[model samples]
Target: MSDLRRRALAGGKTVSRKARSKPESGLSSGNHTPNGSPGNSRAGSRANSRPGSRYASEDEYASESENDDIMTISTNSVSGEDDPGNTWAERLQDRVAELQDRKRSSVQGREATLGAYNHLLKHHFAQRQLDKSVAELMPILLRGIRNGSSDEERLRTLQAFTLTVLTCSPETIFEQALPILKAACQDADAENVKVEAIYALCIAVSYGGGSSTAAEETLDFFLEIIESDGQSVGAPDSGAVVTAALQAWAFVASHMEDLTVQSEAAIEAFIEQLDSSDPDVQTSAGVNIALLFEAAREYEEETGESFDMQYNQHRIMTRMAEIVRDSSKSVSKKGRRHLRSNFSSIVTSLERGKGPGYSTAGRAGPNPHTGGPRTDEQGEFREFGYRERIRIYNQFLLINTWSLHSRAELLKTLLGGGFGIHYLENPIVKDILGSADVEYIPNAKSRK
Candidate 1:
């Protein structure tokens, strides 16, 4: 195995002491399960542990009807299911049985697991279905991660577990799944498993009705992973883990309404990553820095108060510009090109104080006298910021804010082909976006 992969697999399983302490900003305890809280035990009902604003408010139905909701959802037909016995729950149950049969070949078990996940992505699961199934499903899935025959099987199992989190009600799984997922983050046997676990935590906290304080604590935990670069945590020097941590941190940070509390330290940490040997790490850091700037701008618009975090914006912009034109030979030509493209967007975002993509107002051509490159009205290089498109039913949802953009990217990575389907049908997704389908269109049209 490659060195990077080895380190990733050897990631630390312990949460840092610093992460466990209450955040300095009066935020809630960052621990996955607060001390003495009902979420303290695996068997504890997470859905009832805390009063949540989003997921809890929506889960007001009677407990007796939980099974009814599950049956109703499980009985619904998914596209291309011709067999009467091939309902989602039955297929899932069959796969689980196949997986549990010790006599089955490893290949058969892996395929069975994948088949179950494929079925999951085909339809959204209601809260009742999740509540009824999670008790049985989570343990088996966790076992797959620990005992699966190959790294591929373990990774697929992790992916399936994340899909289960996303497709079902977040509250149903949040309390029960968070600690186990954190244990996966500390997995010393598989680096990819650790990476996938971090992503899973991001999804759970974001969709599972975690408070802004919980989100802040989650971001802090990821930042520790990123800043340590896997060494302090007893993991190897793996850029993949750092990159995953960085991206996951940004994914959760993007959802926060205010970043001022974390801005100065977070931006400084991200700026240091601009010097990373891994190009992926560099770009992820750059994008996150831009996201901070975007958050600051949004905060200013909302509160009309200047953000207190102070840093040399000029220096950061200069470093991004240098990255845009870097010609170092140690980096591959493709890597260099990607850095240029990513940094160009970062530079644009910093220069314009907005997310990347060209200006909505028609751009004026290059300087008439200097005959320079294409520039916006502000006379800066017209660099395009990365944008993701999601089709919700008939309308195309444009993700433009750094927060929404981060969520879209993370969802796409987690859900793969099912992102569009979830974006269309999942309430958790809609809640995260806050009517983004309705909010972003006019802005996109204006930017056209």
Candidate 2:
């Protein structure tokens, strides 16, 4: 048994020695030998290396080491450029001081400083610079909003911040700048600040933040201003506030899918302003209403459903006609002419069966005694006589009246013969009688 054990040990030792003496292939094996070959030693060194392979002589390690050395040197050099003992807060204070000093220099110098600050703000918000600008500007803007700075300065800062917020990617701006915008909207005291804050909120929303919510808040703020008793005071520039409210509404309307749903009360207030004594306010209201109607019409056309099927088209038409007929208002003539023109188009389209049909085209026919309807009371009739109808047809022809395109076919029947120019001017006709054409008359030779 002792002899067998010795032989087994000797065989194992022989196998290990042969394995060690064999030439290394420079490929990984379970065991390695020292002084094998330069290639094998290098391979063994790589295999034994750490996860980061710090001992590996690759170019990437060399470059990384060089970069680390450079960064170390830069840190060591810049460490004391500002006071080494200064806290991060103190550094920020010093930097802000420097910025202010630059801002207080000559106008050109101040503008340049602002421009550089704006550029840095943009880069920080964009996540390109990723420095203190994003953190620092927020407090500056908040201070401006809280303290009510000059309009120009407030406007400048707000515009710069707004541009930064607007131009940045959605995620970054939402996370970093959205709260700032909301705070500005809530805290701003200066009208220009408020205006710019609203505008910035609008831009942020456009870029995909809490646009709908921001719009609602802004609209609510304006509505409050518009409804307050202080609006009646002459000192606060109520007109400017009203104008800003209107502008915000316009922006909200453009961005919102169901503006009427969200702003029904606001819309009603605007509609009420249509009857204002001030022409400018009234005109603005009218234009906004028209825009709303136009948008509703386009929506209906696109979706194949009316916004208000039960809406009274006739009421609008009648009101417009009454305005034209009043003859008391300064816009009476213009209102009447527009009403007539629009009514004519409506009649034609309706007769063609393309729209809601209502024909008022031939309401003003000619008279037998006057040729055309008298501009007096007697010519107002619910119906017409045969000669009067013929004269009406003539007047319709002169006006190139629509909805009466078939009038050409009825000409001979209406006139009892082909219409002669003499029919245009008869002696018995009170109107349309001057410059009678003798050549076209049957009695022309006898009269001559």
Candidate 3:
């Protein structure tokens, strides 16, 4: 064994005379203390000079020592020393510039350099380690999506960019990420790339300011994707694509006022997806439809004009009923609740009196009693049909009449007079009267 190894193994004890005689060896240079410090040389020499130190009994040393002499060398070795003053940022910038220069030289080099850039992007995103320089790198990352040699590289870069954007400050992502997503959405070769880009775009929209613009652009791009020849073989099965589009629609539906300015074709494309085989797509489509209805309803209430429902109310009601009666326990439970909760509005609209032959015009034919002229005696009696009176009574029963005394009185008058509840022995009326403890006479004269 070499002198240094031998002395290091000696557990800080005095060096033997035989070891000291080997001055030419690296360990005898006086700078070879086990702790790697030259200051410990005198301590080692004095211990060695003692009479029995060199030949000390192993048990004596063991009994005196509290610990084994284990050298603690740092694992981090500095090789071919570089300037310590250079910051990590400077080094990274130099490395990035060098790779860019190499990429400018040859196509093969460019591909290799791009691969490294993508790898760094993924690492930074996964590590969530963003710095000021990363903002500068954002354009470079965007360029990779545009110039990537393979679809896989583009997809990976796009995904990394999206996560980075989502994790980044809103202002930074808005400024750096939105344009790349928009460009990627337009490129036909970058189908998978579109998925992440759209997601990032949706995130950008959620950040406010140019959000509506981003939403419009994203919607247009998605409509193009769904209507593209590539999507003709089968519907767009891309979940990311569907989710992004749906989220954007929800954002726009809630925020944007100029729906007419949005492309009609986009709305139609979404409507078409309502029939998609994919349940997620169908659910999103259904939500969008509901949002549209809510928006329309608000518009009508604000302006007092009808907005086209654009869907068959009867068909929807029938489907809801089927869902309510579905054999699947889960379906029946949820569906029945939804139906019972929503059916009154639908039934009221359908039961609202219309012109003669109105209901029959579009279907099997109008109900004989729906719009027919009243008999002279019936008109004199001021009576309503059994179904019509029951519907009105149900409507009144659901109102919060207890808190609104005037509303309660108005309801009582309407039910007793116009609805002819004064003469009817209706179970609904009986329940309402029993709950309120108010006597209702079917034939009672109006008091007011």
Candidate 4:
């Protein structure tokens, strides 16, 4: 392992611009209970505790425990001078150029390069900045990923590339970044790099505004990885790579309007995945099952036709219930708890004939202004369909569809502390979340 990554995983200090703070990542599942939102109760407490629960990537440092440490860089690190008036674009251009000129052969120089990139990621970049700097950033980022002196540098560069695709004009960097990401996904020597590469590719396809055909093709690639049990990527069936592939597949699939054509075989695959011993792999597979059911429900409603999933619904729920109540000695307390909470929500969604978050206690229905699932005699709870809510600034962006929810979850994990800033300033982010139901709170404190 690279020295930097080894330090990070061992909970030692590594180059980070600021001491990481636990931002109130509004990514918490908002299932409403009788008392209040699910965040207040034990069953739903996991949502508040780990904001980046679904991310299998190495960048999820913020979700680590309080004891985990990172070395901080002072303001002068970027350029020996303090220039408060410089925009992010100017600073980024200067830093990227500095990194390019630095010798990777020198240990100090390489660490400095990683710190510079980390500092950029800590702050939000406005659309103006991204537009001005993306052209200059892409080639350097590509080189850092493919030929950095260490794995840590490559991983950080890949993360930066991900944020770029999410916030910048896709046309500017998509073509350049996609090919490199594809090659990285198949890299046999670096499993962490390959897992991260798979996720980065999914983000590129999702927000790139590519055609539906492109999205399907990318999803097919991920499915092959899962079906092959990571043999496609040279990893084991229960490895993190397969878990990442499963999540990535669901993240992309959530965006499609109708997945009926692929539902039966895809669902069967998911069911088989549930038998895997890895808790992460099991949870990911379970969520995909719920996602498929959610998609099937919507399709049937829209087309006024029967969307037969061809699987036994009762049998699936029984398996999900077993995981919820599981008390096996093999699984740790934390793992059991996570499994219970997630599957409990899934079970509720299935029983209620709603989507993933519906079964949780404290959720309100989709924002009333944005039309949602049909309202009926069951009151607002019944109206609570599948969607996730993101609390950013004073606005609540309600991602009222499973597809948008999947995209939002992944973006939240990638952006971390910068998510609210990007949502407020980046037009590309605005476009991806454009259809979300918006709720404005008059005087709420910002939750970035």
Cα-based RMSD of the predictions, in order? 16.4, 34.5, 30.3, 12.2
Tens-digit per-residue lDDT, 352-382, candidate 1:
6766432333334578677865555546553
C-alpha TM-scores of all predictions: 0.68, 0.39, 0.39, 0.73
Cα lDDT, model 4, residue 341: 62
Expressed as tens digits, the lDDT of each residue in 1-448 for candidate 2 is 3322221110111123322322211111343322122112210101111111111111111111232233223323122233334322332233233333433443322222333333223212223332335444445544443443344445545655554443332433544445665566455555555555655655555453555676567556555544441152221433434444444455445545555454446546655554443333333333334435544665677888766523344554354345334524654554434334444333333233222122333355468785877554666644211111122222312212211211221112111111222233221111222222122223323211
Write down the lDDT of every candidate, Cα atoms only: 0.58, 0.36, 0.38, 0.59
State the lDDT of candidate 3 residue by residue for 112-175, as single tens digits.
3333332233222222234434455556667776776656546545644543443343354565
Candidate 2 stretches greater than 4 Å from native: 1-139, 169-190, 226-237, 275-284, 302-305, 309-448
Q: Is candidate 2 or candidate 3 better by TM-score?
A: 3
Which prediction has the highest TM-score against the true structure?
4
Angstrom error of the Cα, residue 118, model 4: value is 4.2
Better of 1 and 2 by lDDT: 1
Candidate 3 local lDDT, residue 320 = 37
lDDT of 4 at 316: 94
Residue 220, model 2, lDDT: 68
Candidate order by lDDT, decreasing, is: 4, 1, 3, 2
Clash number for each model? 6, 0, 6, 8
